[model samples]
Target: MNRRRFFGFLQKEFRHIFRDRRTMLILFGMPIVQILLFGFAITNEIKNVNVAVLDMAHDDVSRDITNRILSSEYFHLYQNLHSEKEIEAAFKSGKVKEVIVFENNLAKNIYSKNIGNIQLIGDATDPNTANTIVAYTRAILLNYQQELNKGSKPPAIIQTEVRMWFNEELKGVYLFVPGVMTIIMMLVSAMMTSISLAREKETGTLEALMVSPLKSWQVILGKVIPYLVLSFSITLLTLGLSMFVFHVPIRGNIFLLLGEVLLFVITALSFGILISSIAPNQMAAMLISMMGLMLPTIILSGYIFPIDNMPVPLQVISNIIPARWFISMLRDIMLKGAGWSVVWKDTCVLAFMAVVFLFLASRRFKMKLR
Candidate 1:
């Protein structure tokens, strides 16, 4: 390889990419797309499901049970039907996702020491979410049943005391808001920085940067520093929304949370720089970021699914995702109120990844440009 010719080519490429108006527009748009996707499109919690209630019993006890189901925060009783036929119409029309029914002799059976049925018919299109809603509906009815049985004790009581650790109210946005924000920031920062650097090569301006007597690290830092400011500001804005708007609590030290956020940002930036070292243009850089970072962050980082329950291969794959560490760290701090004492290991892992990527990217970049 002719070292002088290669370096000359690289500098020329950098100058071209930096000067393009379209390249500049994409650089800013990346952050916005990421923020919107994480905020609106992706979520794990289900709520405000519309339900129809049918009171076949048509007695005082049945009315009381109907009121109990309607009272729950999870289900909105939009349709109260007199017969099961009305429930069929509601389901057929798709206006209601769930139908609740009380047996005809609800009070009489309980008074005569008989067990009656409370039927829950759920829409199975989204099985996972529907299942959760059904469970919650049963819980409400069971609580009412327990109240009635308070006068008489059973032989064995299978009492379940569900304690949602870290998040007391189990707000969807509580853990999700922080985790999604981390993911969006990582995607935008990494993609924009990588694409910005690669565009220089695509447009043939990198030669100017290389021939200016500026150290390789200085050039890299110049591109990186501006994005560092932007990403952190976005993080702060997302956190504020979570706290003030969504009412997500921070149970851990603020300093520690900030430290982890910075670490993940640096780690993402390093990976972006690493991608830029090999990619020849903005299109390549964008494709690499989407396929390599954004998709994995959304699917395998435990952002949408519980990691522990996943297959062993996927769980192992998730170990390499940078967002996995950030997801855990943020959830711990935001929901559980975790501190350095709890997340130091994760911090160490992220720091190590950043340093490793930085080393590889610096060497690859210097060699590629030269």
Candidate 2:
């Protein structure tokens, strides 16, 4: 009889587990998503990196080298530059990662003097990617030099000069600071606010507030203001540490950086409110914030991995992650010294996301109140 009772208890427990949607999502859905994301999104290999060529030589040799670099799986020809002046603009636009400049009369120098010079300029905001790109370009040039030397008396030598912009020392901290800042702000602002609001709901204090004379927006504002201040304080602290300890430069306008930070904080807070509006309790809110916001912010935001290296579907999904834009802006402002013109589009996207999130959250809050 005791054995039969134990069997019945086990069956009951299994039925309860299958019946709870949240438990099922935690047990099954999260593992599947995490495995797929780790498998596809986590990669060090670079592919289809956009590069521009300034072929001043414009001769057969220069053309051949240009073709070789672009033909490789690692690089795609983004554009042909007319002059050295266009090179800065291309890098500033953030579309072109590396620029190859062929010295004038490259073919002549190689054939007559048995020597040629090529300059490679790489955007070093992300130092790791820049190093990989430079190494790959050098390998290709060496291969071309080897091809020219087969059964020849004198081997033609190609002198390659590498220049890394924005980060001369290839500091890994430059990359980590902005990424870590984004992750920290997203968690503190979004997760804490969501959990805080969800606690009020779970404990029935939120219903008490709703029954009071305060409007929904007012209540939300009350909840958000404290977190907003906290998030801003955290940002300032991080920035101070980055500038003083890590020696990362803020070459751009300080006011612009602070403004962008403020905007991102608000967006994160609004997103937290949206999550709280949907979540049933503190645990659900915390879980959703961790699973939905934190994972995407870390993996899909190009924090550690290059977005260009990710698969197409994952890249598409990254566009929706707010941290992606914020981190890009932070890198541009803090590392590259980008001005308003360089970061305006990203600013606009964050603004749009904030508005949409607030609107949806407001509607959800009102529906729950009704």
Candidate 3:
């Protein structure tokens, strides 16, 4: 209620932040480092994938397709397998991702039936890579067929229309940005706030504040408001890196995106406050936040892995991770160009989390300070 006191409190909080070199580095340096690391280190694009070719036809058409697959930047022809028995060895050696087998009569089959069956045997150990290898091989074969058709008289050409939604280019950075933001926001808001508050408790400053005119809520607000500002700045830094450095586009409304970010920050801050309320010391607070919050956010938030592919139990557990809702909301906004109508459910879920966390943190705070 007292404007002067609140402004002084804010000034004091800002001093606490700026005076600490480690805190300043975390507030500014960590976001940039993390964004760059994740943006570049992890990627989905496959290149120079080793492949084995079994050319039974050994004819011009078969050889041409083999050359095409070999010359493709996506694949490298590792070796030529003599027979069916050699296919197993290539794959087992872990050097070959795919074995392209040309059937007995490829040129004859194409000339007569207008179709040729080329079996693609993939190493199912890495399903994603195997799938990509098959797709690229298919494209090469289709191109060859189209080239042959142009020279000859074909009765019909079945054209297949392909459409890639959200991420047309399929750059891994597009997926990484939102997920990185989720982890960073959680780290900055909750982990940082909890540790800061626990430090106050360890130092006896919290007791001094309790004895002062500051209400318990005011004390908690003073601690987190600085983090709120810092977290927003980190968000901006992340978005800038995502857009300018990585070229990840924001397809939806910027204001809406930021609003959702703020909501998530508040939720994380509240959760942090609750952690601080119970933690006996700063070390304990940091450990708890790292293990309890960061690990779950990374593993269960659908950041690096697809939720649909997770087991039924893990999928159910993922529902409780707030980052799950936040990441989906971000993807919907940035990738899908979705408005409130599309992402309203995710937004509502985040809002509910914010309310619940705030309530629990407040209750825990009153109990602790009393």
Candidate 4:
């Protein structure tokens, strides 16, 4: 009930939140640093991957396909083996991530039967990347098939020429950068904020804030405004580094990007506020944030796996994840150079989530105050 005591306590509480080194690092530093690192680590496509060629046939057709793979820059030939025995050695030596084998009758088969089989041996250590590499190898063969089929014009020709757009190089790291940034921001903004706010409740300070005349809105604003600024700055910092240092592009409207970022930030902050309302302590808040939100954001966000490819239930689960919309928006704008016209659906979904989260947070906080 004492006005001076309450304001003084609120100021002290704000200082504690800001001064905590771990929280500052998590809120301000991780978004930029981790996102950039993720950008480099988390790509689904493959390029410039080391590959070995076992051309037992040594024929013109096999030589042409080899040249094509080398020219595509998706492959760097470390060895041109003379025998099948050399293939096992090349694969085991770890000198190559993939091995392309041309059978001894490659030329004859192509000329007479119009079909030549190619064996692609890929390293399964990095299974995701290995799968993509194998896909690329198949694409290379398919390209050759199409090039041959064009002249003879075979009916029912299965030709596939894969063109990886946006990230033409299809480097896994480049894809990881944005995704990591998205994930870290979602975690830090929502969960970290929630845990920090919940700490005061566990310590009995939040009750004091509720009783203060500073107004509940001001107290909530004071707690969140600083972190929001910090998190938003981190987002911009990550984007800048990804664009300049990593050579990533901002292919969409600058204003739209900033606007979406604001939406995402507020969404996270609101979620944090809501968590703080429900959680009785910091540990519970942290656990709820990590398990309930962060994991889903990463898993369902289509950052680590393609959501479209997931099972029906998981795909349904993805609908509730804000990161899912943000990731889709980011890809549309960042990779596809899509405009608001194209990304508006995702933007609307994010906006709706923000409204829902803020509404819940506000309602829960009001009830808590009483």
Best by TM-score: 3
lDDT of 3 by residue, 103-191 (tens): 78777777777767788887778664565567677788788777778858863232222221122334567888899888989999999
Per-candidate alpha-carbon RMSD to the true structure? 6.5, 15.4, 3.9, 5.4
Lowest lDDT sum, 10 consecutive residues, model 1, at 158-167
> Candidate 1 — which residues are off by over 4 angstroms?
1-50, 71-90, 109-117, 127-171, 367-370
Tens digit of per-residue lDDT, candidate 2, span 297-341: 999999978798899999999999999999999999988999999
Worst 10 residues of 3 by lDDT: 158-167
Q: Give candidate 3's whole-model lDDT.
A: 0.84
Decide which is better by lDDT, 1 or 3: 3
* TM of each candidate vs. truth: 0.76, 0.57, 0.86, 0.76
lDDT of each: 0.74, 0.81, 0.84, 0.77
Query: Tens digits of per-residue lDDT for model 1 on 204-236?
Result: 877666766666776677677667776887778
Deviation from native of the Cα of residue 327 in model 2, angstroms? 0.8
Candidate 2: list runs displaced more than 4 Å: 1-170, 367-370
> Order of candidates by lDDT, top first?
3, 2, 4, 1
lDDT of 1: 0.74
Model 4: what TM-score? 0.76
Task: Indicate the TM-score of model 3.
Answer: 0.86
